[model samples]
Target: MYIRDVTKVDIETVARISVEGWRHAYRGIIDDAVLDGRSVGEAARQWQEWLEDLVRRGDRLAVADDAGQVVGFASYGANRDQDNGFDAELYAIYVDPDRLGRGIGTALVRDMGRWLEAHGYEDVVVWCLKANPWCRFYGRSGARPVAQRIIEIGSRKLEEIGYGWHTMATLREE
Candidate 1:
């Protein structure tokens, strides 16, 4: 597997992974109707919009490619929360449902740190749904709980926990 900045050609596959991920990964936590209603075409449109913002904000989306398929992706950028002190934010990370547990997430997080560091960012924050099992992964990665807020989706309000590191060095693998 390899990680690289996304190109226009990758949007569709990335969208598919993201939509499928929300459907599979959040099955029990998120509203079933909400997840079931998401469409790849809509996701692709949203990604296109994010790509446009990426150019203007100097942010990026990177994808993990395995034998020509985009198995996972992560987006990072300047922190959007004005009250937060984090230098950057990991906006999202989603791996193909079928590809989980194979270290793809590890590779994606590693690459995210490298990319953010290269661009002069030090502190980083990532917000995960409180019920997401992957929250454990963030804890193991050295992210301390830094903040919390409620986000509403399809009539349901869920808590999101923000995790952060004062320095990316804490997130690097041994």
Candidate 2:
């Protein structure tokens, strides 16, 4: 497996994996219609726009590849949290359903943290659904839940938890 910066060529693959990962990971948690009607093409277009902006700004967008295929991807930048404490935020992290449990997610996050640290960020934060067990992975990776909120998407109100890692030292040690 190889991890590197995302390119325009990876947009479609990342979008597909993002859609599939959402469908599999949020099956019972979110509205079924949302996942069922997810448009990979729209996602790809959105990724293209995002990539263009990232390239212009020189921001970090990382992808994991196996056998030349993108299996996972993550995007990070300055903290978007309104409270504005952490230096960085993990905007998104999605792994192909077939690649789950293979440490791809972990590697993506660890690398995101490393990138943040290298770029002068003192802390990194990520938001996840409170009901998702993936929080365990974050906990094990040295991030602790620091905040919570209920966010409404469509007609559903979902619990969102924010996790923060103050430094990359713990991820590095792992």
Candidate 3:
């Protein structure tokens, strides 16, 4: 598999990944009704706007392509909310539910770190629902718990944990 920048043709595929990833990974951690209500069309629309915005900001949106199939994707940019010493933020990352545990996420994250560092960003931050098992992935990627907050999703209040890397080198490490 290889990672590449997202293109307009990838919108539907990555949209599916985003919706499915949320439904599978956030099942117990988020409201059931919220997950069930997600539709690829809506996700694609949001992704369209987000993609345009990322380009406007000179940020990035990338996908993991496996034999022409998109299995995962990630986005990052100048930190929207500067905290600690981090100057960049990983906005989102989702592996196709069927592709989990195959190191796609690791590759995406490593690429993100490389891209950020090459752009002169020193550190990065990412946030996940506090109850998300995916936090384990962040921990494995050399991120430590650095911040926390409460966010409301579909009328439900959820706690989120922010993970941080003090140095981009941590992510570039093998």
Among these predictions, the greatest lDDT belongs to 3
TM-score of each: 0.95, 0.94, 0.97
Residue 163, model 1: lDDT of 94
* lDDT scores of the candidates, listed in order: 0.89, 0.85, 0.93
User: Which stretches in model 1 have alpha-carbon errors above 4 Å?
Assistant: none
Q: TM-score winner between 1 and 3, please give it.
A: 3
Most TM-score-accurate candidate: 3
Give per-residue lDDT, candidate 2, residue 96: 90
Query: Taking the tens digit of each residue's C-alpha lDDT, what string does model 2 give over 1-174?
Result: 978998778889999998898888888898988888889999899889988887787678899988899999999888877594787888888889887889998898878877878888888888999988777888988988888889987579999999988777866766
Error of 3 at 81 (Å): 0.7
Model 1: lDDT equals 0.89
User: Which prediction has more favorable TM-score, 2 or 3?
Assistant: 3
> RMSD (Cα, Å) of candidate 3?
0.9
lDDT at residue 27 of model 2 (Cα atoms): 85
Off by over 4 Å in 2: 82-84
lDDT of 1 by residue, 136-158 (tens): 88887778999999999887899
How far residue 83's Cα lies from its native spot in candidate 1, in Å, is: 1.1
How does candidate 3 score on lDDT? 0.93
Clashes of each: 0, 0, 0
